[model samples]
Target: ESLNKLMKNLYSTHPHFVRCIIPNEFKQPGEVDAHLVLHQLQCNGVLEGIRICRKGFPNRLVHSEFKQ
Candidate 1:
C-alpha cells in the first residue's frame, strides 16, 4: 500500500525513463543482445512519453542531486 502510493507520487511527475541495457551475459565485452536491449526500451516510455527539450536536452540534475 505504501509502495503503491509512492509509485503514484513518482509517476505524477511525468518522469522520463532511461533503460540501461545489459547486452550479454557471456562475459563478453562487446557482445550485444539486440532482443533484450530492444525489449527494455519497447516496454518502457522510450517511444511513448519521453519529454525532450527544444535543444534536445533531456533533463537537468544538479551535482548534489545526482544519484549513483
Candidate 2:
C-alpha cells in the first residue's frame, strides 16, 4: 500500500535529480582533484545533460518571473 502511494505521488510530479560526486577518496577538507571530478561528471552524463538543456532552453525565465 505504501509503495503504491509513493509511486502514484512520484508519477504525478516532474522530478529533477541532484547528483553529488565526491571530489576525493581521502575525504579530506579543502582537497579537490580536477581529473577525478571531470571523470565522474563524464561518467554520470551531467556535462552532456547540461549541454542539451542549454541547447534546448537557454533562456527559460523572463525578468519578471526571475524577480519573484
Give lDDT for model 2: 0.82
Alpha-carbon TM-score of each model against the true structure: 0.39, 0.60
Q: Write the per-residue lDDT of candidate 2 for residues 1-68, one digit (tens) a residue.
A: 99999979977975556789888889788899889999999999999987988888443557896666
**Residue-by-residue lDDT tens digits, candidate 1, 1-68:** 99999979976885545667678767589898888777776777564434445347556677786663
- Each model's C-alpha lDDT? 0.69, 0.82
Output the TM-score of candidate 1.
Answer: 0.39
The number of the candidate with the highest lDDT is: 2
Clashing pairs in 1: none
